[model samples]
Target: MSQKKVDAYKAEKANREKIMKKEKRVLRLEKLIALAFCIVAVVWIGFSVYSKVNEGKEEVVVNTEMDTSALDDYLSGIATDAADAE
Candidate 1:
């Protein structure tokens, strides 16, 4: 082959190799991005579910009633005792 044709072939081969490398890099980057997105989505969903499951119970309630009659009687007795002492 002529020198010009040989040089052209080498240049074309180099261009093809460069294109292939770029395509491969782009494909690898796309795969990595998809994997990262999947991981993030899974983690977000898991966290949401965990928070919902572990959240505080909203139905827990406590009811109490106190009687004050005994205390009042005791105070009245003390007042009577003090009056008697005086």
Candidate 2:
């Protein structure tokens, strides 16, 4: 084959190799993005399940019915007895 034809062929081969490398890089990025989304979806699903389990059973501390007077009254008798022992 002519030297000119051989050189042209070599240039074309090099260009094709460059495009293949770029295509592989793009495919790798796509795979990474897909994996990231999968992890996010799984975490979101877990949070949803946890919230559902706590539904209606979750208690608010401020909404309690505890009476300070009753608790103090109950503890006063115990403290008095303990002091009498001393």
Candidate 3:
């Protein structure tokens, strides 16, 4: 082989260990990131379910006021008119 090709091959061999270590570190980081994402998704889903259950357990209150005086007056007028007709 040529002198240049021999030199390049030796240089690559010398750095093979460093390249393998870098690849292992990248793979470990990817696995850690995937685990973290799964944990976060589970926590989010649990929190939403908990919140919905608690929301259903809560009581809602409604306040309203009504006046019936006009209805009473109208009924009384009707009664008087019926008596007058009789």
Candidate 4:
């Protein structure tokens, strides 16, 4: 082979360990990031489920009594005024 090719091969071989270490570090960082994302997703899902479960247990109070005394009095007043006008 040519001397230039031999020198380039030797240089690459010399730096192989450094390149491997860099690759391993990048892989470890990617794993950590993925793990963190999974943990956050689980926590968010758990909170949503907890809130939904508790939401169903709450009691709602509704006022169902129909009090129409004031309306009746108002209508009576209007009727009396109309009778007086005539």
Candidate 5:
């Protein structure tokens, strides 16, 4: 082969290898970004579930006893008033 042609082929091969290396580097960076996103999603889901579980554990005691007592008092007062009138 001519010296000029050999040199040109060598240069083209080097250029192709450089492009491949650049592509590999970019692919690695994208993989790292995707991994980071997955980590973030897992953490978010874990926190949300933890918060929901804790909320369910914290039960509010609704006092229906007070409501019933108030109703009983009003009814008794009406019944007494009626007996007094009769």
Candidate 6:
């Protein structure tokens, strides 16, 4: 084979290998970025859930001997007012 032909073939092969390497590097970088984003999203969601759970832990007090007569009277007054408005 001619020396010029051999040299051209070698150059083409080298160029193809270089392109493949670049493509592989780009793919690896994209995968890493996606993984990092997923980790951040998971942490953000976990923190949000933790905050919500903590906020829901409010204490509510109830009196066993509470009187209901005043509440009943107030509701009755409201009902009468509604009827009058109608």
Best by lDDT: 4
Residues 10-73 of candidate 3 have per-residue lDDT tens digits of: 9999999999999999999999999999999999999999998898686779989899999999
Q: Write the per-residue lDDT of candidate 5 for residues 30-55, one digit (tens) a residue.
A: 99999999999999999999998898
The TM-score measured for candidate 5 stands at: 0.52
Number of the top TM-score candidate:
4
Q: How close is candidate 2 to the true structure, as a TM-score?
A: 0.53
lDDT of 1 by residue, 1-86 (tens): 99999999999897998889999999999999999999999999999999998787577689999999999999999999999999
Q: By the TM-score metric, which is better: model 2 or model 3?
A: 3
Clashing pairs in 3: none
Looking at model 2, report the run of 10 residues with the lowest lDDT sum.
58-67
- Deviation in Å, model 3, residue 8 alpha carbon: 2.6
Residue range 1-86, candidate 6, lDDT tens digits: 99999999999897998889999999999999999999999999999999999996988898688889999999999999999999
Off by over 4 Å in 1: 1-12, 57-86
Among all windows of ten consecutive residues in candidate 3, which has the lowest summed lDDT?
Answer: 51-60
- Superior candidate under lDDT, 1 versus 4: 4
Cα TM-score per model = 0.51, 0.53, 0.58, 0.61, 0.52, 0.51
Q: What is the C-alpha RMSD of each candidate to the true structure, in Å?
A: 10.9, 7.0, 12.0, 8.7, 10.7, 7.6
The digit string of per-residue lDDT tens for model 4 on 1-86 reads 99999999999999999999999999999999999999999999999999989986968898899999999999999999999999
Q: Which prediction has more favorable lDDT, 2 or 3?
A: 3
Candidate 6, residue 20: how far the Cα is off, in Å: 1.0
* Cα lDDT listed for each candidate: 0.95, 0.93, 0.97, 0.98, 0.93, 0.96
